[model samples]
Target: MKIFIAGAGAMGSRFGFMLHQAGNEVSLIDGWQDHINAIIENGLEVNYNGQEFNIQIPIYNQKDLDINSKAELIIVFTKAMQLDEMMKDLQPIISKETKILCLLNGLGHEDVIDKYLPAENIYLGNTVWTAGMTGPGKVKLFGTGALELQNIVPGFEKEANEIAEALSSAGLNAKYSDDIKFSVYQKACVNGTMNGLCTLLDGNMNEVGATSTSKTMIWKIMEEFRAVADFENINLDLDYIYDKILEFNDINKLGNHYPSMYQDLIINHRKTEIDYINGAISRKGTKYGIPTPYCDFLTDLIHAKEDLLDAK
Candidate 1:
């Protein structure tokens, strides 16, 4: 597979490194200059399951990418808010035969991708795979997770499954899904609960889940997310989803991993994906005439945090 990982952040780095190690010709493009230069100077250093190693993978910034180059598979890993810009930057590498696998978090991303690429070329999916940034070009990856994917255009199951098989060959644990949108909503529930609360509390998933206050917040947020999802005709098992998110905290699934929002606002002082996550729920809640006070407040709170970072 001639693979190009667009956005190449934590999860993108993980996928590109894994696929490249599996003998696929993989290249990467990212907006972060620090990360790009780090990888260019010294291969991406990955610490997986307690073993640390490096793979000399080719990476480039948007300015440096070769426009005439083409890709067989282009996996989008951009933050929800960054998708439009990323897709535009990645356009030159996309050909008619290009299969775009978007494992980005949050709802309503396929619509955005649709604007930039052919609908038939798009693959909508989600993953439980988690990775954390340790430095500019280094990441810590642990635990086991699977990739579940589906073709955005209906009646393309065989084509979607072929991509899954290719990813599975690289140990991505890929599976073709008949209902990936459902999986995506389910995954969003996990993110909405853990990412917001964990970031606000400045704690790891375990640390936050240990608090009664956090549990109460999780319930409120899930209920609001449930109502909004229900309006969209996505039926999520509320109790199962809530408990599943907490299970990561209870057992240290990510092992003291502070959710990405925390790293973005607090550590790097960058903006977050709040507008697409909880903020998206709040917007839909408004459209459906359902009250999502909890989500609304959290969205405001995250924005305030962002403002505070900027002020500092």
Candidate 2:
């Protein structure tokens, strides 16, 4: 399979590395110029399951992505806020038959993707894979994870399964889902609970879980997410999602490290996906006359932190 990983951050790099190792032709496109240059020069160094290997894969920054081949699959790992800009610039490779699998985190991404691609060409999914960027071209991949994907529009179940099978060939543990909206909201709950708190408290997942007041506060946020999800006709199992977010007993899942938002904001001084995660809930809640005080508050806090970093 010919695949392109758009927005090749930590998680994106994990997928790209695995797929390239699985014998697929993979190309990476990301906004991080240094990371792109480093990968192009030294290959992508991945520490997976305690063994490290450098896999040479082609990487392209925004100004350098010249493609003559049509991508069969463009797995989007781009930030929710950057979707529009990415699509406009990615016009060169988006053929009519190209299928876009959005593995990006957060909510309301479908609407953004829909603006550029037809419903038939869009695939929606969520991944529980965890990876950390140790440097520009390197990542620490501990343990393993799974992927769940489904077609964005009805009647494309066959194609969705094909996408899953293609990813599964690369040891991605891919599975086809009947209702991807449930998975999206479920993962959003995890991000909403841990990502913001970790960023605000300057802590890792375990540290956030250790906070005595964490569970109750996280429950309130999940409840707000549940309400907003309900308004959209997506039913999320709040208790199940909450337990998954607080799964710190195992280091492989939701432990030992800061969530992506913390890495984005505090560590790298980059803006976060808060507006599409918690802020999406708040916006939808406002639209439906539902109160999402916690979501709104956290959104404000993250933006303030961004502004603070800018001032520094």
Score candidate 1 by TM-score against the native. 0.97
Q: How many residue pairs clash (N, CA or C atoms closer than 3 angstroms) in each of the candidate models, in the order given?
A: 0, 0
Model 1, range 280-307, lDDT digits (tens) per residue?
8999999999999988998999999888
lDDT of each: 0.87, 0.88
lDDT of 2: 0.88
Q: Estimate the TM-score of every prediction.
A: 0.97, 0.96
After TM-score superposition, the amount by which residue 177's alpha carbon in candidate 1 deviates from its true location, in angstroms, is 0.9
RMSD of 1: 1.4
**Model 2 worst lDDT window (10 residues):** 246-255
Give the local distance difference test score of model 1: 0.87
Candidate 2: segments with Cα more than 4 A from true spot: 248-253
